[model samples]
Target: MPETAGPAEGTTAPAFTMPASGGRTVSSTDLAGKPYLLYFYPKADTPGCTKQACGIQEALPALGKTGLTVIGISPDPMKPIEKFAAKYNLTFPLASDEDHKVAEAYGVWVEKSMYGKTYMGMERSSFLVGADGKVAKVWRKVKPEAHAAQVLEAAKGL
Candidate 1:
């Protein structure tokens, strides 16, 4: 797969709506006029993804204090997302992008090579959308363990 360019800072974020855990349909419109974070991970319940999700959950209070709403998106269906959220006691929304449309729009869907086998997967990434709905920051190929703190620090600057 060719590398696709993502939205740059000051560019409008791509719009999307996906089925979230708790039977909610989360849409970019729902976050209208509010700054938010949209993160994409490869899969639900996997080790690295789990660590990433939990880190965001742990960082929620501080992030919330900054008035940023965080949402995690993955190609996994709603069932797995629900399980992942419940298992980790996550308070934020975990949206399902089973068809990968949202991930593609965000440029987080990409081809991957692991152990010499190539496949399509969601790249671990986060986008900070400002209150005006433009990109504020972009984190590509994120490290799962320390990502949330980094995002919070950036959000504070926003």
Candidate 2:
């Protein structure tokens, strides 16, 4: 397997605090003593991001049963984040990392190229932080359609 950025399994997840939709804020401290998922996406309201968010939304009740809290993080501002959540009826917190500090700490911020133009962007990645506060799993370059199911399977064991 190729090496990926961010905390590896068995390591402590990076700390973060940011504004989220629904007039909420999420932080590493707030999630302590509980298993949670921090999923990073490129943008809000985009096709792939939409699919991922919707899939997670559909699985929220099931995920809740597993006691796994899900938070979606993106580099977009809170405005777009709020709109996206409202439009999709996503109740879970969707955070805005406008400065990308959280994304950088998680190692999900990286360089990218599109149409032969190089730029920086958020990587489609996730970190599953177990109740003990260490990362139990890490998924890099995630496939939106399968993300929630994959997360659900892993969370069931936690």
Candidate 3:
């Protein structure tokens, strides 16, 4: 299980590297010195997760104008992520955190209960990292709909 708490705003974003779709890997170092969004979701291709990802994908053009790159993270393995990206035509990175190390570092990996069954899973969360590598904002228990627009607005201030 992940530690009980996530990084607070103004703290330096935790660093991590994970395999991603498109035969590539994404690392925190890749986003350093730039404003970026790191979002965590439970699974790939599922309804809510897909909506969340597609929402961000839809906002990419607007978000790009602000120079804020976005990357989605999940504990699902590579194949599923590849499928998800291809299915949705996602232009941003979707990383696979099979070991959940990155999610653990971000404190988005946690115990969750669904329909009375408890298990560890990735929480629906997002972090906006400023150019200085400090976290500018954190969103926990995010709703899929309208989240991209909210994050886009928040990024405008960064």
On TM-score, the candidate that comes out on top is 2
**Model 1, span 42-117: residue lDDT tens:** 9999999999999999999999999999999999988889998998898899999999988888888888999999
Please write out the lDDT profile of model 2 over residues 16-39, one tens digit for every residue: 889999999999999999999999
Choose 2 or 3, whichever is better by lDDT. Answer: 2
Model 2 TM-score? 0.97
lDDT of each residue in 1-158, candidate 3, tens digit only: 53348788999999988888888888879887999999999999999999999999989999999999898999998999999999999989999999998888888889899999999999999999999999999999999997999999999999
- lDDT per model vs. reference: 0.91, 0.94, 0.91
Tell me the spans in candidate 3 whose CA falls farther than 4 Å from its real position. Answer: 1-4
Model 1 alpha-carbon drift over 4 Å, by segment:
1-4
- Model 3 clash pairs are none
Clashes of 2: 0
Instruction: Tell me the deviation in Å of residue 25 in model 3.
Output: 1.3
RMSD of 2: 1.5
Task: Please give each candidate's TM-score.
Answer: 0.96, 0.97, 0.96
Could you give the candidate ranking by lDDT, starting with the highest? 2, 3, 1
